[model samples]
Target: MSNLQNGFLLDDETELKTLLFEGEQDHLTPSTSRLLLESDFFVVAGRIIGHSFLNGGPCLVGLSQGIIHVLFGGEPETATVTESDCADQDVREVIRMLQGTKDLSEEEKSVVLSLTLPWDLPGVTVNNRHWLQEKILLHAVLERTAQQVKQIRRGLKDTGVWEFFSSRPDAVPVLFPRASEAEITPQMVIDNINWPKDEDIDEDILSLDDHCLIMSFLRRFIENGTSDILKSLLTFWTGWGVVCSNLEVEVIDCSLPQSSTCFLTLKLSKNHKNYEDFHQDLMASISSAYSGFGQI
Candidate 1:
């Protein structure tokens, strides 16, 4: 007011350009803005979320609204140019209608594509403008994937379907595990599995009851397990190949990241006389196996 006679301040296009072109701030913010050309419907990849101080500099954000919108250097202002105001009438308008900016259509796209000297023009490079475009696309795709996974988890929770690993350290149920387990009392083991003295042959020592019980247990495991786990089990069950090199076991997880692993339990009867000793031995074996000091 004091420097100028009129209220109108001096317009300094040079200063405005300088400020707008100033580089982004890396640490304080994390939002990305790759301007996109709007289609009939909003494609999820074409939107910016959050706010970031981009120390990365004023990138020529890709097409949006069939126009160019340049974000100023860390400022709220974004320079805009509409398709009507563009230089060419035969811009790829038809091609854009058929294919989104995900494909190429210069007439319909706001940004230009060129490979000449000083190639940093706003409208150039159909698919490859800034690395930020891919980042944005990947971010959106991953977000959708995560959402779908959450939905699946909710569905699984509503029903009683989840993992049923053989052995896990901190075994807990993500969802109610299918009831494939039964109490193995000492009497059952003795009556069904015990064999006559000095019976070393597998055929001679086998018991029908024990075999059937094991089969029933496996059925439960397959029924409750994931498709992948079930396939693996079937593959092994079919005797794909029998090799004795090292004892190995795999406990697969088929649930959400936030949820707990599948339920699992197999041991001597809790009320058995040797339960304490058996528990001690089992615990030791588990600990040692994890520590790489023991084998199955």
Candidate 2:
């Protein structure tokens, strides 16, 4: 739904069918029995198959179709060039011509097809029979590029860090890892946390991961009447993993996210030293949320 809201074209049922299988007119069938898949293609194909099984359905035939879509559509593809443009030119030079694209615009994407696809044209077809065999090397290069791209994308998607930053690319200061744990103070952690962190953090300071884990704990505080959460945060010694019954932490009052930017203000115990430092870091995190690097 977020992807839809973000203007991404969701694959509809028809498009999904076209993606998974040959259309009725294409008359293609799966060849599952005697397969000699390359190592890289096999890995990509396996992932798509698994994704389809879990998301699409349990059918094996559907899995095969899904694999086919991922191989060609692993990423957005370039446009094909028309046959006339590169008809008389050297195919190698034509390839060299298109290699500079850091980002392919819709118009230019297919332009390279004019060079390579025509290699099979009537006049050129007879002369390149040998080159066609050599095309195996070209196929290998493309397959390898696609494999590498999938792994890169998968890694980024798995880490919430990617979502956090990609949603606000201009937030450079927040990109740095939280200051070393030893240098962080409990008050510093409270100042910065608008959400629960991913790990049990020790006292010196709570890092970004700690905030992600703690967000949930603070929600009930909002429901309860106590408004000052600062003292509760300081109860556990730094570095405690799971909460202890004796020293369980709780939130009092807090403010976050009247907007997408979380401007958290925790009233940790009064008279804490480095109070100004924690405020500065909280401001930086808010600035990051707003896509502005906080003022140094």
Question: Distance (Å) between predicted and true CA of 255, model 2?
Answer: 22
Q: Which ten residues in a row have the lowest lDDT in candidate 1?
A: 48-57
Q: What is the C-alpha RMSD of each candidate to the true structure, in Å?
A: 25.3, 19.7
Model 1: per-residue Cα lDDT at residue 213: 43
Per-residue lDDT, model 1, residue 40, is 9
Q: How do all models score by TM-score? A: 0.19, 0.18
> Per-residue lDDT for 1-296 in model 1, tens only?
00110112225654321111011211011112222112201121111110000121111122221111111111112223232222222232322332344555565344333211222334435444444233222232222123322332333333322122113213322111112221122232223322223233234334444434433443344345453343222223222111111212211221110101121122221221233343343344333322232343
lDDT tens string, model 2, 1-296?
11111122325654331121111211211221112123232333334434433342221221122222333343322322222212123444434444443544444434544434544422123344344323422332233234443542343344333344445645422322112311333434444344422354443454443343344333333233121132222211221111112222322223321122112233232222243443433333333321232222
Error of 1 at 197 (Å): 26
- Candidate 1 accuracy as lDDT: 0.25
Superposed Cα deviation of residue 123, candidate 1 (Å):
5.0
